[model samples]
Target: MLSVMVVAATLFSVTTVMDSVETSIEKGTARLGADIMVVPAEAEAQAKTALLAGEPSTFYMDRSIEDKVRKVKGVKAVASQVFLKTAQYKCCSVGNMLLIGFDPKHDFTIMPWLSKELTRPLGTDEIIMGRGLTAYNVGSKIKFYGKYFEVVGMLEETGMKFIDNSVFMPYAAMKKLAEESKHKKGVKAANLPIDKISTVLVQVEPEISPQRVAIFIEHDIPGVKAIVSEQVISSVRKQLFVLLRSILSISIILWIMALLLIGVVFSMIVNERQREIGLLRAMGAKKSNIFRLIMTEASILSIMGGIVGIVLGGAFLYAFKGFIRSSLNIPYLWPSAAEYAVLVAGCLLLSFLTGAVAALWPAIRSMRMEPYEAIRRGE
Candidate 1:
């Protein structure tokens, strides 16, 4: 009985740990920026896919469109951003580095996240890189497709799927690289002139509805797609929660099945020990005392198993934290107090239930044992 309790408790702890790890990774991405996104009509499919899948993606947007967007009601602030495609730099290996071209002086929403790392707002010739570009640490000179530039700053680790693998620089820096590479190698940047940004980040007044603003933009503006941060995050969150719930459900079902097996095993043990139980009864032990002994053993086993499982689950969560975040396209935050409370409580409750359930049949059988027959078996 004790062994059965231990096994059931261990499985419960495993389920809790998995749940916490999944939640953490999803929340990390939400912390990096606003909830909304704007993409070019032509590139919306690719952008949405990348954002959800944690893969590299690029899109084009006309830089001139910002002026028109700013005029819309409820626009608190707007920042234009472009992501350059991956191409060979003069001296570096090929990897897609996000070239963010925004109004450095005016674009403070995303800039604050990069400020402490950068010497100053990026200049035409200077650039700040994502943690993914750590190879070009501060003071390292880098040449992108033949245009020479020095890495002035490296972004803090956000644990985000996309941000972790990106690099940012002034739009002009990218334009210069495109032009120079074209002149020298007779090739054009995937997208030229770079006047259009891939997306626009918008901040709206609290009193204004982002949904309303998005609707207005789509209706009033042409050649663009507008979506509020709330809309994007809500959509993403919904999908993630669905997955989390499914996992929880499966874990719960697994635990219940394990508990049933435990009960069956304990009942069988009781049958094999029928004579031993009858001997105790013959020795003047009360039926209640016999039941208590069995219950005590089951309880002890459950508590011990639960503790071991909790420790092992914690280790597993720590080891695979990064993989979970990257593969799921989410950020990872350590388990919080509330989450830990739930995990511990669930484990304890499940463990106790398994032990009690397992003892039920054995307890009843012991109560019914006859001392006369038990004594004969002992002989």
Candidate 2:
């Protein structure tokens, strides 16, 4: 029983970590797919490759493309965004950061899905800081590029590498910031057009295939590249699936070894108690009574091990949730009661099967013991 408990705890911990990692990757991929990404024709290769490699990259495209993309067949809506590369500040400043500009009312990805967590909605002079934006939150005013904006919302931790380190604000504010920076350095608008956008997100009509639509946009829209949800998430999904399969394989091997070891141990115990069994049989202790004793012992061991395993697993998850979330780069939520219950039941069932299998050899051997000879040998 003690051995079973130790093995069960180890197996459960391994499985729990495996599940958390896979689930985190899956959620991250889903969140990354909120919209189809559009990039500049010239930087298409760079942008796509960067995204696939899980690195950050930006491209330049005309803001006017928004109107054109919005009208494309199968395109439901379009929003433009620009990302500024990180820069070192003269003094202590927000670390490696990204400045994203979007139209709040029109940007479905940020305004609809993410802003609900805020006390107030996003606006032109308001910004929504990502999880990585430090020393800023709702009601805080931040200045960038000489343009000031109030932090009206804050994003919950979504384990994406880029989002955790970026800040999101309105396109108007970003443009204003650019103008201010240019004026400070005496640069002219003619040299730098504020109408440039780094990328765009297009929402596809429900009836249209995203892949087909992406192809159409790529062909029809010159100087632009289109990528739908599948293109971005497929690679991540494959990586996660591979990891999950490997972990499950390990768990199965551990479980089998545990069952076999348990069987061997119990077999030895039954052999040592042969004379006791023989005496009981001679005294008319029914075969069923002998069977019950073996079964009860197995059940006790299995149940105790299974329960301890589950509790330890839960504690591990609770203790290192933040670390896991950061490492995997996905939103975190406490395991729902339903999920936890399923884990407990599944573990219990596996344990019970282990106990039952381990008891089989002992059961058969004890049933065949010769009463007189077994007792005489013991004497």
- CA lDDT scores, all candidates in order: 0.64, 0.67
lDDT of 2 by residue, 81-179 (tens): 787653444211342356777776677666543634554555667778766556776788775544467877777644454554567877776676666
Error of 2 at 85 (Å): 3.1
Instruction: List the lowest-lDDT window of 10 residues for candidate 2.
Output: 184-193
Error of model 2, residue 225, in angstroms: 3.3
All candidates: CA RMSD in angstroms?
Answer: 5.0, 4.3
Clashes of each: 9, 2
Name model 2 segments beyond 4 Å from true.
Answer: 1-14, 29-35, 41-56, 115-121, 132-135, 146-148, 184-193, 276-289, 307-341, 364-379
Candidate 1's residue-wise lDDT over 12-35, tens digit each? 434554554455334434434543
Q: What is the lDDT of candidate 1?
A: 0.64
How far residue 343's Cα lies from its native spot in candidate 2, in Å, is 3.6
Best by lDDT: 2
